[model samples]
Target: MAKRKIRGTEEAWETGELGRDEKYVEVADINESTIDEALELQMISIRLQKSLIEDFKLIAKINGIGYQTLMRQILKRFADSETKRLLRECVRAEEQEAKEQRQMEEIEESRKRA
Candidate 1:
């Protein structure tokens, strides 16, 4: 069996000071005034499964966004997909109706010639 590498000591893990790397620059006080407020947000409360919420938080953290923002993005994508699907179905239905109408007109013309 391969030996697994142990993580940092308890003290380092607890203090969360693992000697900051030079590559990681700490940022503070970003001015978001330039950002456009295109959408008016409303606050609402809802219940979600604990595990699902945890997964959302983990994914949001990975993407460097808040969980609520991630959820909104996900919802928007789903809504757009559903809207496209409905539009395609409507177009197909209209095409089918036009095809049937053409077929009926051909049958009527043949009857008139007979």
Candidate 2:
């Protein structure tokens, strides 16, 4: 492995290859009317108990939002949380497997030496 000197160039930055400064941008004036519509959605019909729907509606009313919107938020939050947890577990399992593999390799090398 050899260390190499890297050349720095200002052409990439000075030529406006990067976007213009948006530090003074106003978000409230932005036309995002169709932003919600732009998001992909799938429609699926499901059967739910009346009590559940009533509970969801009550919660939604308290939150000042529609029940369906509240449901979507809850589902998205649960899914995102579970995804992060699963990813962490997967990484831990992979690290443990790699550690075991390295230990086995060391043991095999010692056996060969014997």
Candidate 3:
């Protein structure tokens, strides 16, 4: 067996062999809920066009990730961007409204002085 050095570590291990401190655990007893909880994931289902799914699968294969994971990442990015955009719009609207209110107050004060 060939020895391989782990990246960013001072440890070396033999390729194609388990370390003395490592052992494989039996996975037969593990269930979906256990995995979801460990990964902090929630299960969801949605229907999409077959063509879209196929496209995602091809892209994900090229990127070395599952299609579902790619879709989740895409959704997260869109949500974050959309939330920021909406927040900016809200701030602009609030600022305009405050400016209009100040203008109205100034007009009323001028009318009272006249």
Which candidate order results from sorting by lDDT in descending order?
A: 3, 2, 1
Candidate 1: deviation at residue 87, Å? 0.6
- Residue range with the least summed lDDT across 10 consecutive positions in model 3: 8-17
**Pairs with steric clashes in candidate 3:** none
lDDT of each: 0.84, 0.84, 0.88
Query: Which residue ranges in model 3 land beyond 4 Å of their true spot?
Result: 1-31
lDDT, candidate 1, equals 0.84
lDDT of 1 at 68: 88
TM-score per model over all chains: 0.63, 0.64, 0.69
Which ranges of candidate 1 are over 4 A from the true structure? 1-38
lDDT of 3 by residue, 31-71 (tens): 89998999889989899999999999999999999999999
lDDT of 2: 0.84
* lDDT tens digits, residue span 1-114, model 2: 997643445874577544445875556754454555566556669999999999999999999999999999999999999999999999999999999999999999999999
TM-score of predicted structure 2? 0.64
